[model samples]
Target: MKGLGPQIPTKAPPKQSPHFRLYARKYAKSNAWTLKVKNPEHSHDSIENIMVHPAFRKFNEQETSQTAQMSESLLMPRKIWAQLCSQRESDRPVILQYIYNQIKKVKKDKVQGRRPIDALIDTFKEENFVWSSERDA
Candidate 1:
């Protein structure tokens, strides 16, 4: 699902906007999901703006691998975005939001089912690190 571009506030009671709707229906027999369009007459000005939309924007395989590796190394999202942008000059520039979302997903995958603190503790143990905590009175 892509954004409908920037929105402009209107003082009028009724704001003019496209009424496009899509529905996903599950087949009763097969339990398969199928998409159905309610209205096809959607008004969109330009297709180029889709490149900036986070939902529609995508990273290539190389960029995806790089993002995963960098995320594992604990690199900041902004730095990762800059590195990706500098690596290539494509028609579609990398969106910072996309990078941030990707990094979040990567980190979540790394943590898997374990709690974040548990994962950190496991990492520390793997590295032979030590820490101690004291109760406050």
Candidate 2:
């Protein structure tokens, strides 16, 4: 009567979109959060892709504290990285550069805008370490 088969428009429809949108909300009464996914399909598989992401390589709180303690103890970043890798058997190994950066960050925080020598002197004073310097005639 009208048409024998489906109709194809003169203009092509829009291409398949790859965007994935996820929304999260927390209710005032509940301690849990709810996640709403607009597009459940993911662009890539997480299992194979997660290890390559930089965010996945970040240290957790415990690792950060351990790194700080090790750095304060004068352990080299490479050794610290090795120790961290040995402690964790994750798919992504702890990077040496990350260890170096973390140690640098810890040291910077410890210095707190003051010079390193000043911080060291403060630490020595706190620990009651005595040092006397003789004036040259």
Candidate 3:
């Protein structure tokens, strides 16, 4: 009679790379957007395949990259946002509102201030430009 065999620990398989996961998620979202916009009759797999073609793949990559950069900028910490608002007056109100909204979503207190539109006018000075005689005529 054989003694009890040594126990072997079983572990789950390693996860997929982050790049592949990002690619797959972006591809799925883009495919859905395309289907909605064009009302196509293709299956999900077929649409996914088409969307992964070299041309569409490159386009998707660029779009995803740009979106990532934009989100990173938009999600900067409050201190960073304040610094940016101080440096870029034109962007202050929009940036402030963005930060406020982010805070508000998590039920945090927000600094009460003027609306984004008011900030825009204050930042840009809407009525101070002088028009040329020819253009006015």
Candidate 4:
């Protein structure tokens, strides 16, 4: 008589270990932890686990939206300014007027109360390009 051989049970593998589930739940409850604490923002998220811990879900959404908007506002102007400032002297005059215009626009849009001349002076000084009439002897 063939005995009730190999008991067959229908069940899926446990999705997560009990220890991991507990740790995840605890991690999702802490808020003051920095992004570098165990889970950085750039860390890869697994499909089996939630991408963002519960504590950071709302904050992450707000931060993402604000960052996108800020990037849009600063992207083009910053690129143009950086490119112009990095060019050689002989290649700069053509873009000088464009850079000057962008500086004015940034000041106006940001309401920073800085004059274009002052900004140009600061940029030149920061780049170590301040002009002097002294000639090499």
Candidate 5:
């Protein structure tokens, strides 16, 4: 039972970017089912684990009950999976390209920690996004 360093207040994530809302409306007829209960084909099991990485598990460590912690674990992974799935119905190819570029910067700078973006890029690749070297025209 010990307190960690100076506790920083956490902020709720902002609403989805305006672009996602507009994009969703355009694709709603086709992509709306992703908002349902089933796991979309794109979410690889290993990649989803990144959301619960040890670096982040502490955020849920103080949950008052096991149910709260369980829901916390399930909700974040599902939300991220659904967002990426729906994103694919639009310009996902371009988004994956953008994510690949960010990954390069992280590697070039020798970033010490495993960042959230790194996990995202890895998941995208696992979901079949080809890297530039292997990309086809």
Candidate 6:
């Protein structure tokens, strides 16, 4: 015989949990569901937080491998190129001035159609050189 009351079922799980009543009471209205809506789109974390796209990463790897395969000595650094350019710029005016002076020094009519070597020979007179005299002949 049980106690004074009628016998109830043995221990079994009821449908609801202890917290369900409090949760249901807090969110009772149908409009409550609309207030607590969920976003469908979710974002995941990247490997190291440096989100480089796969295509760019592949291209970079290919470029690095190709460069490695070639002779590394041929690759000029930025500082060297900059120095070369600056040197050229500095010397350009001096070279141009020298060329200008040389052009001005040249006689126009005397050497107009003649080659440079021929014109230079013509500059000296024939009297400058004397033939050896045979007894002052």
With candidate 2 superimposed using the best TM-score fit, by how many Å does residue 65's alpha carbon deviate from the native?
Answer: 1.0
Give a tens-digit lDDT track for model 4, residues 1-137.
24768756679777443322112323556554333234233334465644334432222343334334444466564565454445434321323344445445545654357766666666678899957444368
Candidate 5 structure quality by residue, lDDT tens digits, 10-58 = 8977644322221123355665433333333333235544533544332
The residue-by-residue lDDT of candidate 2 on 91-129, one tens digit each, is: 676878888888889879988999887888888889999
List TM-score per model, in order.
0.60, 0.56, 0.16, 0.20, 0.17, 0.17
Better of 3 and 6 by lDDT: 3
Once fitted onto the true fold, the runs of candidate 2 whose alpha carbons sit more than 4 angstroms away are 1-48, 132-137
True lDDT of residue 60, candidate 1: 84
List of clashing residue pairs for candidate 6: none
* Candidate No. with top TM-score: 1
Off by over 4 Å in 5: 1-73, 76-112, 129-137
Clashes of each: 0, 0, 0, 0, 0, 0
User: What is the TM-score (0 to 1) of candidate 5?
Assistant: 0.17
Q: What tens-digit string does per-residue lDDT give for candidate 6 at 1-137?
A: 66779987788867342321111224566545323324433344345623344432221333333333321334433433343335442222222332233333333444788876666555543546433323334
Better of 2 and 3 by TM-score: 2
Runs in model 3 deviating more than 4 A are 1-76, 90-95, 100-137
Better of 3 and 4 by TM-score: 4
Instruction: Compose the digit string of candidate 1's lDDT tens values, residues 5-29.
Output: 8766656565456578999989999
lDDT of 2: 0.83
lDDT of 4: 0.46
* CA lDDT of every candidate: 0.80, 0.83, 0.42, 0.46, 0.42, 0.39
